[model samples]
Target: MTIRPIVRYPDPRLALPAQPVTVFDGALRELASDLLETMHAAPGIGITAPHIGISLRVVVLDLDPVDGARTYVNPEIIWASPEMILHQEGSVSMPGVNDDIRRHARVRIGYRDIDGNAQTEESGGLRAVCHQHEIDQLNGVFWIQRLSRLKRERLVKRFEKLSRG
Candidate 1:
């Protein structure tokens, strides 16, 4: 697996909706492997296909080293609880900037495995937050877009400064 360059923030691709994976083949597996490597290099807990200029609906998450990694294909949120939680959300695309964003405390998502098997996961806490965050990205809604206008502007400025320095 190769570590691919992450697509930076404000890139038009990050705002474009990703297409569902139509074929589950070796190339798909390789892409997932590459995503894991790239996420690790980015030092991010999660990443999506669009994060690396791949317009496919795939996500790789490794919240715990012990748990290893998980690949979600064409993931869609099937359910979300009314309870909300505030979690600090950042992106591999926009490194060095983060903000607490409100998200569902619990979520259930349906997705396919790398081998094309269907899977559903119910999660709470950080896992739930990740599910929502990455799924939003697949829908072309960057994490900062969920922030208040003032907060989004401030975070973008901070990211810009970091990029320059």
Candidate 2:
């Protein structure tokens, strides 16, 4: 697996919705592998295809590098618990910029495995936050959208400042 370059924030591709994965084949598996390598290299717990400019409905996540990674194709959140929690969130695409964001404490999600099998699972804590965050990216919704207007504005300004430097 090769580590692919992650598209940084302000890239138009990161704001676009990803296309669904139709064929589950060797290439799909390779992409998943590459995604895992890339996400690990980013030192991030979660990453989506759009973050790397692939524009496919794929996500790879592994909170602990020693535990292996998970690939999600066409992932969709099926249910979310009423309880919410705030977690500090950052993006590989927008490194060095992060803010506490509110997310469902627990979530049930449906997705396709690399072998073309349909899979469903529930997750909580950082895993839940990661899924919700990556799913939002698949839908072209960046995490900062969950923030209030003031925070969003501040983040954008900071990104702009970084670009200038």
Candidate 3:
């Protein structure tokens, strides 16, 4: 597996909605592998396909230190609780910026495995927030979108300055 370059913020592709995966085959598997490698290289717990410019409903997560990687194809949040929790979240695509965002404390997600088998899992805490964050990227939503208007403007200005440099 090769580490793919993450498409940074302000990249149009990061804001564009990804296409659904119609054909689940070797290419998709390779994409998952590459995503894992990229996530590991970034030292991040989660990654979405759109972050790498693939624009597909795919994500890789490895929140556990011992367990193997978790690959999700066409992941969808099935259920979310009303109870909200604030977590300081960061993204590989947007380095050096962390935002405290409110998200569902618990969520049930459904998605397809690498073998084309359907799977559902319940998660909470950092895992839940990370999963939801990455899934949002699959739909072209960034964590900055969850921030207040002033914070969003500040982040955009920071990113703009970084780009200028």
Candidate 4:
């Protein structure tokens, strides 16, 4: 598996909605493997296919090193708890910036595994936050888009300065 360069923010492809994965074959497995490797290298908890310029609805999350990684293809949020929680979120695409974004404290998502098995799972806490964050990217919703206008502008400026340095 190889680590693909993560597309930085402002990349047009990052804003475009990802297409669903049509076939679950060896190639899909390989892509998933590569994405996992990339995510680990980024030292991030989750990553989406579009993070590496692949516009497919794929997400990998490895919240705990001991628990192994999980992949979700064509994931869709089926249900979200009414209660919202504020969690600090960031993207590999836009590093060096983080802010508390409000999201559902718990979520249920439906998707297929790499084996093409349909699955639905509910998650809470950091796991839930990570899933929501990555799933947003799959739906063309960048993390910063969840922030207020002023916060978004400040994040942009902060990212600019970090990149320059």
Candidate 5:
């Protein structure tokens, strides 16, 4: 397993829709391992395949305060409650900034596990928010996208300025 570099915001790849993983081959397994390593190295709770330049519907998350991790392949949000919560969210791709984003407090997700078994998990609070955030990355969406147009523009400018220096 290797730590892969994260794709930054405003990159074209971040806006490209990821393809579904059809073959559970060794390469796919390696990619998952690499993603986990990368996420852990980033000290982040979640990561998506596209974040490492792999445009596939794969994500790794370690929301457990304990020592466990969850890998999701082709994950889909099956259900979400109307009750919402706002949390200050940050991304490894967009360093040095965080924004409060509104998201469902609870969600039911369906996906295949690492062993190729189908499973569903009902998550809430931080888990729910993390899952939704990672899933959004799989679909070419980012937390900043939830911000207002003016705010997004300001962030873009900020990112641009930071990149220059």
Candidate 6:
């Protein structure tokens, strides 16, 4: 698997919604593998196909080495808890910047596996936040959009400064 180049912040493609993966073939498996390599190279916990400009609703997450990596195809949040928690969030596309974001403390996600088998998983804590975050990305919502205007602006400025250096 190759570590594909990530589309950086402010790229118009990053703002656009990703298309759903239809054919579960070798190409889809290759894309998921590439996404895993790219996410690992980015040193991030999670990443989506959009992060590499593929525009497919594919997500690869490796929250912990012990649990191993997971590939989610066309993932969507099936349920979310009313209780919320503030957790630090960031994106592989926008490196070096993160902020506290409010997200559901627990979530149930419905997605397909690499082999196109339908599956569902319930999670809490960081995994729950990751599910919400990556699904939002597939829906064309950047993580910073969840922040207040002032906070988003400030974080963008910092990211810009970091990009420059």
Candidate 4: where are CA atoms >4 Å away? none
Instruction: Compute the lDDT for candidate 5.
Output: 0.87
lDDT at 30, model 6: 92
Clashes of 5: 0
Ranking, TM-score, top scorer first: 1, 6, 4, 2, 3, 5
> Lowest-lDDT window of 10 residues in candidate 6?
58-67
Over all chains combined, what TM-score does candidate 1 have?
Answer: 0.99
Estimate TM-scores for all models: 0.99, 0.94, 0.93, 0.98, 0.93, 0.98
Relative to the true structure, how large is the alpha-carbon lDDT of every model? Answer: 0.96, 0.92, 0.88, 0.94, 0.87, 0.95
Superior by TM-score: candidate 3 or candidate 4? 4
lDDT winner among the candidates?
A: 1
- Candidate 5: deviation at residue 66, Å? 1.8
Candidate 3 has its poorest 10 consecutive residues by lDDT at 156-165
Misplaced by over 4 Å in model 3 are 161-165
Per-residue C-alpha lDDT of model 6 across residues 1-165, encoded as one tens digit per residue = 999999999998988999999999999999989999988889899999999999899999898879899999999999999999999999999999999999999999999999999999999999999999999999999999999999999999999999999
Candidate 4: what lDDT? Answer: 0.94
Which stretch of 10 consecutive residues in model 1 shows the poorest summed lDDT? 59-68
How far off is residue 78 in model 3, in Å? Answer: 1.0
Which TM-score value belongs to model 4? 0.98
Worst 10 residues of 5 by lDDT: 90-99
lDDT of 5 by residue, 1-165 (tens): 998899888688988789988888788889999998998988788889998888999989887767588789999999999999998887878776777889999999999876677899999999999989889988888879988899888877887787787
Question: Candidate 6, 60: how far from true, in Å?
Answer: 0.3
Give the TM-score comparing model 2 with the true structure, all chains together. 0.94
